[model samples]
Target: MPDFDFTALRRFPDVEADNLFAYDASDHLILDEAADDLHAAAPGEVVVIGDRYGALTLGALALHDAADIRTHQDSYTGELALQNNAAATGVTGFRSLDLGEELLTGSRVVLMQMPKSLSELDEVAETIARFADPSVTVFAGGRLKHMSIAMNEVLGRHFGDVRASLGRQKSRVIRARDPRPSAESAWPQRAYLDELGLWVVAHGAAFAGPKLDLGTRELLRHLDEMNPDARTAVDLGCGTGLLATALARTRPELAVLATDTSAAAVASTRATAEANEVAITVRRDDGLSQQPDACADLVLLNPPFHTGSTVHAGVALRLFEEAARVLKPGGELWTVYNSHLTYRPALYRIVGGTRQVSRTPKFTVTVSTAR
Candidate 1:
């Protein structure tokens, strides 16, 4: 087998900055370990989970010559990158599905990039255990800094055996087999936020889990003060659809769109809206790049400061630009962010006139109108 071409991959649609990288050593480690498993399994029987930017999936297809590969990526941007890389490299015959039975059913081999959250690992473990072939072997890899004893415990709960491979380049792969098929799932967790009088459902991979983050809680305080005539609104970067649900409940006449980059967040938001009996459109998007200009009457955002494990403001700024594009003239963008970030100036320059709506010790809520 030849070496995989890392240069063929790119992280467009996601934040592409100097500090943040596209592929990592763990990707190579997992694909290498899964090579034997891939050979033993039938074509189209191999499942790739948590593949970031086509590394594990494309590498297997391009290098090992594996075909009919199925994949599940958590982030919308990651999926887009995989498609872009596949088009660029002229690789085809791979199917991408959400984290469900369609992606995991009857898979004898699984190559996964271990997620940062143990609960997310648990979600993957239980789903594969229940849905995949009973004899499936899972090759899960991650950097040593991100791996934990708790992850082994999480895997052990679903798999009969779990063992770690030798660490190379500060990365390690954990192989597990003999899945316990009867294991229960803990995902799509539900919790009631009494303060907001709303219930939120979150998948394990959703940001901030099932609880309301301080920034969002502060932002929700002013929901009643929104424009009375506002008919269309967006919960930009909506996580678990907390604000969307709140807005729907407060103003039942408004049409709300809840959008996020993470597939888990989109699914969680849909579940949350259904749980709260609120009607909203939930979608996975690369910010609002797909939205038409001046399509929304208002935009609400609790922008994320991190892309993957690295802290960067580029992700938030990208969303700000998208919001500015989506909102109509005189329309408003309500944003909640950490006080220390001091994003008011950027909001003013990027969107329009920005004014502090509310400020607390930890978070500041601001409203910027589309100029």
Candidate 2:
């Protein structure tokens, strides 16, 4: 049995905005060359990055009887696809990582699909360089439209020596031999929009790193009014650690757990935690991964409405339900969302109560809980 399938993805027209299902097809749009070849080579330990679905991951795992598979993905849907596909194929030896912590390196082979950000690529390069060595090989693959001659050069900078495979399915795989660790440079820094006349530092892979996002802005306004004495809190989708840092600053006594699914977001949040000199726990987590049931006093979120080019509410809905599961009785779950999302009814259904905290012309903030 194939470890994954994508028949369900056909119902949605847009790939970025809808509930995404794992697919066997490669559109050859965001391609990486190394990954194309690895479908055929079954090394025992395979690490995959930017696996949009469980496609490359489970395929590699199913190729061997006792295989080790690791994947780093940023979006909630991407992680969900990995699990759904893994369960479908019964391929179990897989590790799913978000944007930060350290990238798992030193695999017999590493597979990467091209991401949308250059800084992300650099971050992946730096993180993986820490864990790879001469014995490890990194295989990269991308669609011809997505790869350039410089693609191999970028791969060459870290892994040393690059060879390209003949194109198949309009996808070519690049073989990156000799995993020589690259020098640690200053982490990539970019600015993202925040409030008017204000922007924040975002490393690669944050949502709108050069500025504060619209949903996040809606989220930012609600933080100042939350109970200052709530002793335990969580920023469920703690992107770039901005909301978590602000929460820590405002509620000095509140123990806050910050998390995001993006490897880049995790790294940036870690840096943000260090820069603010606050003691917030930061991790690359799936939605509420490390959280315990009925424990959080407050869960703050600006749930994402889209994943990359796709727009949908699957992730936000998932987060809302997750918040419900993790909140203590009488604990509040707060979020800022697009007005068009009509998240209030769903909010009501999950937590049994919902109230609009505030709103902009384009967005609304709501507080819900099992009071």
Per-residue CA lDDT of candidate 2, range 49-122, in tens? 87777666665655433256667876654777667666665667778765443446445567777666666676
Once model 2 is optimally superposed onto the true structure by TM-score, how far is the C-alpha of residue 274 displaced, in angstroms?
A: 2.1
Regions of candidate 1 where Cα sits further than 4 Å from its true position: none
Could you tell me which residue pairs clash in candidate 1? none
Q: Tell me the TM-score of model 1.
A: 0.97
Residue 246, candidate 2: Cα error in Å is 0.8
Name the regions of candidate 2 deviating beyond 4 angstroms. Answer: 1-19, 27-46, 61-71, 74-109, 125-203, 307-309
Worst 10 residues of 1 by lDDT: 179-188
Find the candidate with the highest TM-score and give its number: 1
As for model 2, its CA RMSD to the true structure in angstroms is: 5.7
Q: lDDT tens string, model 1, 83-171?
A: 99889888776988988899988899899999988878888888999899888999999999988989899999999999999999999
